[model samples]
Target: MTDLNTLLQSPIRWMSQATDPDMRHFLRDLQANILKGHGRHFTGNIFVSFEGMGAQAVARLLRDLSGYVTSALQQLCTARSSAGPGFDGGPVRCLLLGAGAYRALGNLATMPGDAAFQAGMRARQVALADPPAEEWGEGAWRPGNPAPDAMILLANSSFEAVTRDLEAAEGWLNGSGARVLGVERGRAQFRTFRPGGPAEGVEHFGYVDGRSQPLFLAEDLKREAAAYAEEPAPAGADTGFDPAFPPSQFILADPNARTELGAGSYFVFRKLEQRVRAFKRREEALAEALGLTGTKAARAGAMAVGRFEDGTPVVLSDNATEAAPPNNFSYANDPEGMRCPFQAHIRKTNPRGESTPKLPPEAPAERSHIMARRGIPFGDGVRDFEADAGQEPEGEVGLLFMAYMASIEGQFEFTQQVWANNPRFLRGLAPGEVPTGIDPVIGQGGDEAARTQLWPAGEGKPMVPFSFADFVRMQGGEYFFAPSRSFLREVGL
Candidate 1:
């Protein structure tokens, strides 16, 4: 029979195929943060979509995941159905996993070689012991579990089956009360990776999504373990790490050096709302300031966001020049806030050039606190909303921003508090250039519209970029330590 090692090695061996430079640091940092503590008390969270199949199949899949529950994990959260009875026009047929459920899933990672999985793996990736779904095959997956509190980005597959298959997964995520979590779409998809910048948002601007992802850490961990198991780490084991803090290490319940229930990653979840129409209205109105009339204004709007409302980045220049691809430019290159404006939404959140000196352009991957973004678009898409619906978003569209960081202060917090909200962005300003402004996107705001402070707005930005007093509001969230696969089996539920 194909042993657990071989099955596990499949994805791990091919790890390099799933990652890029930007993503490695993100996951490593995730490793550090999760290892910092057991994260006993669950807190942060965010859920994602999965491609769907059919009902009888999906409904059966959902039942298998929720078959059992534990006590410790249950106190944290509960999982169930989104739609009322079954998966008809159900709330998209989902599986809401709770902290308790996640903990149970983690244990599956350390599945023993001689365990039932031995026969199971030999049978197929997906195993259906009973009439219901059972194998961890292309159709069936693992325990729908959670990994260590570190950044593994490990998954059985990447393609999510929301309309059909994910009904089981949705149960675990939405079911949990804690936060600090998200699911990624991958081949042999499993929840072994760390999600950042809205924790793997579904769509960037207007793409089908599951497209843009990190550049760091490999995708398959089984392959990595097998490859590096024999080879020694380079001379400076901590080669690319920081001198002041170095990298973080985790201890698990293993023969090499066992520790019960120790060393796991975390899952952080956040439900962020996006004001599509409001954002558009503001952008459209602001375009007038540039004096770009009609077609010109349309271009101006696209440029302001570095992309068209359709999620097409302006940097692409219509695939003409690669000089500036979307999500890859410096706002200061055009200090007038002309090309990619000081108040552009993406620019504000990521603030590429705003913190130049602080960032090592030579090694964009060097920064310790920096993280990768995995935001998914939530709610309804852009649509005309009635004026009265401001309290309740018009179309119900929003971006779930999730980031995995070694240090929340530097990675997550800094990005949100300073870069995204801070006004006097990039140190000194050009003589004639106006002060930096608040990020038009996630930047906060208040009751009155005029009170809104953006570039070329009320009080020319200075100390605070935008004067959004009560704009983006937090709906629900939670944080939990995502343990490694081993920790789940030996010391956990």
Candidate 2:
């Protein structure tokens, strides 16, 4: 088993990983914003294709990247020395290789067993039922941008540090003459930041984001237990389920039992463009239709998102801020989907204590479904839906969604396919009842009719049949592997 110290510093292990040198290597985003309590200060993603690069050139480039890549120990020491007391911010960067990129360099027998990872992003669009060209922006979906072979990420606490790190990476990639690696750049490149300029925790949709994430690592679980002890629980909230996921749950074993890369995780990247104006407009309409006005109108949005904008889960709070958000809860008590709709975004994606009929009874529990979501919101601040009512906005915007998992097919893809996109998810039918709707926020129901959810109307009210306009569009994305430090030093180098 890989030592917890050797793992990455993802959201699941943020508490414990920060102190351990090996684990810190994985905490790519910690240096970005202090107020948000976690995540990168800013993240820059540069996608590249290796169309004509030969094996020798590709190998050389990987070696150069091995040298350029920042280690977590370096980040920790650098942060301590430069940031003064209590600040752990530093210019941190990571490099990942897509399957296309790996094939471009030279096919590897060490690649993961997951078919989804072996097949490129274009293949995934069809398998995942993502929207086709007509539904997506120009050059956004499949076949528009060529599948990228590699992605470089630069993260920092301040905009200047972010710029500095990106410049360094850009300079390395664009090295002149002998240093060049026969690189061919791709179109999908963007940086991420907190919406509304450096103020942390708010997503483009005005929701306090990143709540209810899973806890891993000993320290993370300990901290949560401490917080839960101090805080008042929502009536009947289950706080006893252990959040500590053993390494076997999320880490990949060395496929060859001798390779460094085997210790790494597969990364799933998707650029989801949120239709803010359209979503907000729908919320207003739904609110009015539900006889809710002003603040109550927000409940309509909450019903769709399964959480109030404040990051509180609907199952726990009537309003977004009724009680502070709680991390632990299960669907055992709310089987009928009364408090939280069966197809609500969070419920569909994680389904705590809820049995999924499509999945086997012996299948891993909800803990296995957890993702180390390192995603950051990109694009301009929240769109002025009211002001820009009819006209289109200037540039692209939404989440630069990225998740690190041992199995793309098992965790991230499973959540998307079996849970989120399936309208029949969490089924418990009574004669002639309508099926649950797809996840309104991220679920890509190809047809308009497939994009509907049965909204749980408050106590005694009849369940409202709510239809959803596809609000999130899949821009381009590819799967990549962030190799371990050992892998870089040995095979990648």
Best by TM-score: 2
Candidate 1 TM-score, true structure as reference: 0.47
- Please provide, for model 1 over 168-272, each residue's C-alpha lDDT reduced to its tens digit, 9 standing for 90 to 100: 444553443322334333211011112231222123222223222222222222333454445433231222111122222111122211232223322343445
Candidate 2 residue spans exceeding 4 A from truth? 1-38, 75-88, 107-109, 133-145, 175-200, 238-242, 254-262, 356-359, 381-395, 428-433
Query: What lDDT score goes with residue 157 in model 1?
Result: 13
For model 2, where is the 10-residue window of minimal lDDT? 180-189
lDDT of each prediction vs. the true structure?
Answer: 0.34, 0.62
Give per-residue lDDT, candidate 2, residue 232: 61
Report the Cα lDDT for residue 97, model 2: 74
Error of 1 at 63 (Å): 18
